[model samples]
Target chain A: MSETPLLAVHDLVKHFPLGGGVLSKARAWVRAVDGVSFNVKRGESFGLVGESGCGKTTLGRLILQLIDPTGGSLEFEGQDYTKLSRADMRFMRQRMQIIFQDPYSSLDPRMKVDSIITEPLRATRRVSRAKRREVAVELLERVGLQAVDLDKYPHEFSGGQRQRIGIARALCVRPELIVADEPVSALDVSIQAQIINMMEDLKEDFNLSYIFISHDLSVVEHICDRIAVMYLGAIFELAPTESFSVAPRHPYTRSLLMAVPQPDPHARAKPLSLEGDVPSPIDPPPGCTFHPRCQHTFERCRKERPALVEVTPNHYVACWLHQKGGGKGEPLCE
Target chain B: MEKLLEIDNLSVQFHTPEGVARAVDGVGFDLHRGEILGLVGESGCGKTVTALSILRLISSPPGRIRADRILFEGRNLLDLDAEDLRQIRGQEISMIFQEPLTSLNPVLPIGRQVAEPLMVHRGVTKREAYEEAALWLDHVKIPAARERLNDYPHQLSGGMRQRVMIAMAVVCRPKLLIADEPTTALDVTIQSQILYLILKLKEELGMSVLLITHNLGVVAQMASRVAIMYAGEVVEEAGVMDIFDRPFHPYTQGLLKAMPRLGDRVGRRAGRLNGIAGTVPPLTKVMPGCKFADRCPHMFTLCKEKPPGLFALSDGQHARCWLKDYPERRKAHV
Candidate 1:
């Protein structure tokens, strides 16, 4: 692998304004994604994992520039993407693509399968109509579809087949980096494995890099090389996939891992219970967002927020426990 | 163990324009008193249809449900009148659906919606029902339950709404609780919390539970015994430990192997997940032989010729495969 990342995101921030009217000014902003940074290396799969309303999806969109970030810098292949103009961004679309979560709603019902796969090339006018049709046929076959399915609409296919079409569409332009946001969450368990295996095969065949976003830790652990665990709106742990699974640093990460129910019935259920629900992103807690639910919290966590620091060679954690002489000074509990 | 509910030769079919779809094909199962029976299957495998059939909830214009007997507490539910069924639905058997937002009434307050079951079934006053509802919400671990009573369904978060749904389901103190993918829509932390709440309530109330889910992990954790469904048939029925330790059916083995575990990537490079070879056959495409024969790696000519019946194994475990009937063939193959 190369030292230079295929895509780099730095200090990304996205805030949605709430409760603004003609007579009243804007009250506050919902900090959906706040100061998140990560990188996707060439031919590697990077994962973003978190619970619902934790801004993982928002971070994925920020990288794709689907919705403009309030503040951030995105670099792709040594060029700044956030600084690109409208025309230049349109041209950049061919190199970066997205496969959405829900296959049922992502595809158009009126359009044929062939047209859906070749829409990117059609929009950009990069290829002739005859050539686009030929490319679509090839992509359909590559995704385990037949030529007979080219003329059928999305409604004619099942959930797994529809997801295959979604993948074929994403691969139509031969993008270097693909952002797959919860791609197999909607499918059944067996079908999810099928899609994940197909994705791994395609990545190796095409030499593609991916930014996979999902809430399932096991699925992410199976595919990603590096994983980042997000909380309310910020990342608290980042490490290699093996390290993250075997020796998670952050309390939130450990809790999440213990919370997962294993398939083995003989395995004992560990009671690493959190106190309450996730705090609202609109009115986040004062200091550390996870302090309310964290069991190893201290008085310092209520007054000061910790920054992400390298605890080991490649493992980073944003918790007071890893700080130098941090948790040792405080008492065991409140 | 005493039998709480018994379903014998239950079949459900839908008369669509395309063809007659056999959703559930002669399914049979028994639930013991105060036990949790998990029905595990993928979508279109008839788990949901089987649950809905227990309460006679299927819409009957295009749907038809037939059964030899659906015995509950010495009374056949299939032979009950509408008034009797209505009286038994909320008072003796209640159901919690997958999506709480849609299952709840959007126009009414959460408190009133939860109290409705109590008022209708127990003939309690509105004020008394409301007071009990508040207590129920608090029992489900909802904070400030009394104050949050007047809030509408849309106002509460997904996790809160699910808690409200649980309160509603248990308000009347039913003998059986049918939770169909109850925690599927929630996050991992919230999902564990909900499962724990259900377990706690089940023990306190001593009620039998029918847990319907596609997730093997949830089944392994919550159910004492499980029934594995495939293509509208129960292919394997066994104790949860036996199912995990020694899955006899090919479909069950494929499902367990296909799932990616948490620490599976600790010392190995990322590789393709083991997936089933083919997609599930459509419901309309009925065949006389085993529905899984096409995808089964151990399929023989007998599997394509005739469907196998349940063969008993040790510890009351059963699997529907010809290999169990003819042990010599299995030895020859090995």
Candidate 2:
């Protein structure tokens, strides 16, 4: 991997205004993704994990240019994606694709597997039917779907199979990068492994970079090279898979790690359940978004929002409790 | 050590347009008092159906509890009338659903939603029920229960709504709780909080819980005993440690291997996900052979010919597989 990032997100912010009326011209804004920054290297998998409604999906969409961010800059392959025209963006989208969470709803019910896979090709340009069919077949085979399955619709196949078709469609344009938003979360556990394995193989085969967005820590740990743990609207921790899983630095990240039910029976219980509900995004609390629920929260935490500072070589954490004031807090960071 | 509930030959079938789908086929299990019995399975494996059956909540038009006996506290739940079933539902066997929003009445206030069961089942006055609702709400750690009491379901976050649901379910002081994928919808951080709250509530009330989830890790953490279901039948049943440590069934082994755990990543080849081949068979397609035979690597002619019944492996371990029946002839060992 090179020093230059393949995809860079800087100060990304997406806010949705809620409950506006004529009388009240402006209502409060729900900070879906607020002041988030991250970068994905070429051929690398960067995971974005958060609870539902934490704006992980919104962030992914922002990166893919599906949803326009209220603020921020997205540079993909060193190109300013946010500045691209509609037509230019359409062409640029050929190099980027997305796989949604629900396979059943994501795919068209009326369209056959072949058409669904080749839709990207069809939209891009006028190609010969035979040539399109050939490309579609190649993609289907690449995703482990048989040629005989071309005639069947999405509803005919199982959840995992449909997801494979979705993958095939994403691969139709030969995208260099793919954004998978909870792709395997809807599938069965046994089937989730198959999808993850297939993604890893495809990444190697196509030399693709993946922005894998999911809530499952175990799944993320299995396949992701680097993971970013998002809370409310901001990233609390970002580290390599092993580091994030073994010795998470952020209090929220640590709590998340301990929360994952380990198969080992002898593993001591250190469950640090965060104290309260995720504060409302519409009217979020001042300072650290996690401080209200954090166990290690102190006076500094409630008043000051910590910046994402590197605690180790690559591990980044945003928590006042981990700040270098050397307050009476126990140092869990190694 | 007292048995709170025992289900015997509980076969639940759903009459769909496709066919009469056997959701739960002759399922039997015992829920001892103050124990957490984890019912583990993939989607469409009837784990949720079994839980719904226990509460007599299966929708009759499509669902039929055929050829089974559900005994709760020595009383046959199957024999109970509509009124009696309704009375027993939240009072003795409350269910916490997978999606709190869908389960909760969106139009009603959080307090009203929580207090409805108390008012309906226990015949508490409006004021008394509201008081109980606020108390239980506080018990579940929903901060500012008084202020949030009048808030609608949509006002609360996923975790908060789930807590509200839990509060409502336990407000009746139910002897048994059926949590159907309660934490699956939430993130790991929030999920831990919910798990912690449930465990605390269970201890305080001395309630036995039937936890339905596909995540084996969760089962290992919470369950004293586990029943591994596949295609509407419990293929393996044993202590949590026994199942995780020495799984007797091929399907159970497959599930364990398929999970890409943090621990399993070490010393393992990259891009190697242990996924079982072939998808789960549709429940409508009844077969004489083992339901998992098509996906089983060690499947033989005998396995494809006849469905293996539960064979006792040890004092408390049982497995339904032909390989278990003939240990000497076992091939393709996990």
Candidate 3:
């Protein structure tokens, strides 16, 4: 809605060094987030979806600056966050928060709900101790938890309730952008809906944006306005939610959509003809990272890398099939 | 079709420091020969407990399992001695767990693990068992199965490890297979592959399967019939199509509506997702009424007064709801 996006990441790259010791030097780098670019508009829910080793989680961490990026620019609210000082970054973090996937490990088991919720406020010293407690109670209520639950420990609560605490903690800072990294994946189906609905309500109430990272397409489709389909480390496709679901251009996206098992038993189970598992990110295949498993592979696809190009108004795809003269033969999808 | 397994009035309780938790409360189901019966429910819904109870896997002192009958192929498994149960477990009935890594032996070679069941049950030589194991691994679509056989559990990827687990489970050619969230830990693509593999194996081997999962989509795809569980009770049981097309129980309806479908993104923008209002009731507390009453959207006075029995809807369809008794009231509410 606004001219400047809430969060803008340009060519972000994070490479984890593999096999570093006295005997062996860093042999190689696992390109966790290699040259990824995206922008999250204010009040928008942007989804990052991929398989296990696609580095979607790593990308989320990189955005939050939980881990340092190997290279790229991170601008939040038009300010270059990568260039910000330590104190400035810490202050900036108040505007950006994260909700983890696993509620069991995310929350401090020993700490009370009130202390956990108010930890962010305590770190910044932005409010009085009494005020912080009040904030925690209010935040707890906001997340559909009772004030009485403040005294209870993490172990006392269920998975869904613990996730609510995590949400309450994230909202304690009143962040403009929240990186929810597979927030509902660990939750049961029924509980997952509750959390997703709660998140939607909270987003509306706080006018917050989210970088929703998940492998579940259905959840991503429900919560996200726009989605980016990530591969080994790079985004293969980016499109609006409706367009992506209705007419996905990339073979990977199409395959993913087909792969999701529908809740209707009458619906036919389409055989997923996608060959082999996701290739190792450490030793990624040449050309398109998805080419090895992709059904529409050609001579050109095996030889050159494809750049992300806008095929339609808002739909972007990185595939040789879309580019003119890129495919050796006839393109698979029109 | 012949009934391969029949569970009648099965109950499992765990005595913890807090209280006696009724993990599985009078749950019953029938698995016909060569048919896949999906036990569908969320976490703590006792789906896994029901699966474990079938094999007498629940540890005693803390856990106590009671059943009128647990007839597997005309033999009451509950009446079987330790030695008889041991003989039946891997040979007649086998189970594959959610986490393949932990379920598998970390130190032992994958080949040995897969072959162990055959060697123990069939009294086959180690060399013959290993050869058969390689064939089963190849059947599950594990590439270069012979070479991967020597690798430890840690050596293979998550998807590969799950494939190995599947191979081991099917190597014995058991009469019944209990897959408790077999593909839960794998990615969507790999999950599709595994599900198809299981389907193929079921067809080829003609073995009855009790598929336990929290995912409704998986049930729709894999099972011929479905049993929807809530608070340790099977609230609804019907043919897969019947359950999906016209879910009778409020809990079943809630679970269905709660799922985020790919094409159902319209309501996401204009309206909030249709999620169940409250969290699952704690198993420690014993209530006289329906377990789902606390979270049921259509709760009436009768729902709290007494627990409902299974009301037969059709030949095979059944739902536990008071609304079925008072048809006029149910119609009026609708």
True contacts kept of each: 0.76, 0.66, 0.76
Model 3 CAPRI quality? medium
Report the error of model 1 at residue A282, Å: 1.0
lDDT of 2 at B221: 76
Candidate 3 chain A lowest-lDDT run of ten: A325-334
Residue-level lDDT of model 2, residues A150-207, one tens digit each, is: 9998888999999999999999998999999999999887899899999999998998
What clash pairs does model 2 have? none
DockQ per candidate: 0.78, 0.61, 0.70
Cα RMSDs of all predictions?
2.2, 2.5, 1.8
DockQ of 1: 0.78
Give the DockQ of candidate 3.
0.70
**Model 2 lDDT tens row, B1-334:** 8999999888999989999899999888888999999999999999998888787778888788865577889999888898998889889899999999899999989999888998998898999999989999988888889888899999888998999999989999999999999998887767777888888999999999999998887787788999999999999999988998899887999898898776444444344779988898999997989988999878788988898888898988989898876777656544
Residue pairs in candidate 3 whose N, alpha carbon or C atoms collide under 3 angstroms: none
* Model 3's TM-score against the true structure: 0.97
Model 2 C-alpha lDDT versus the unseen true structure: 0.87
Worst lDDT 10-window in candidate 1 chain B? B325-334
Q: Model 1 off-target regions past 4 Å? A: A21-25, A325-334, B328-334
Backbone clash total, candidate 1: 0
After superposing candidate 3 on the true structure, give the runs of residues whose Cα lies further than 4 Å from its correct spot: A21-24, A329-333, B266-270, B331-334
Best by DockQ: 1
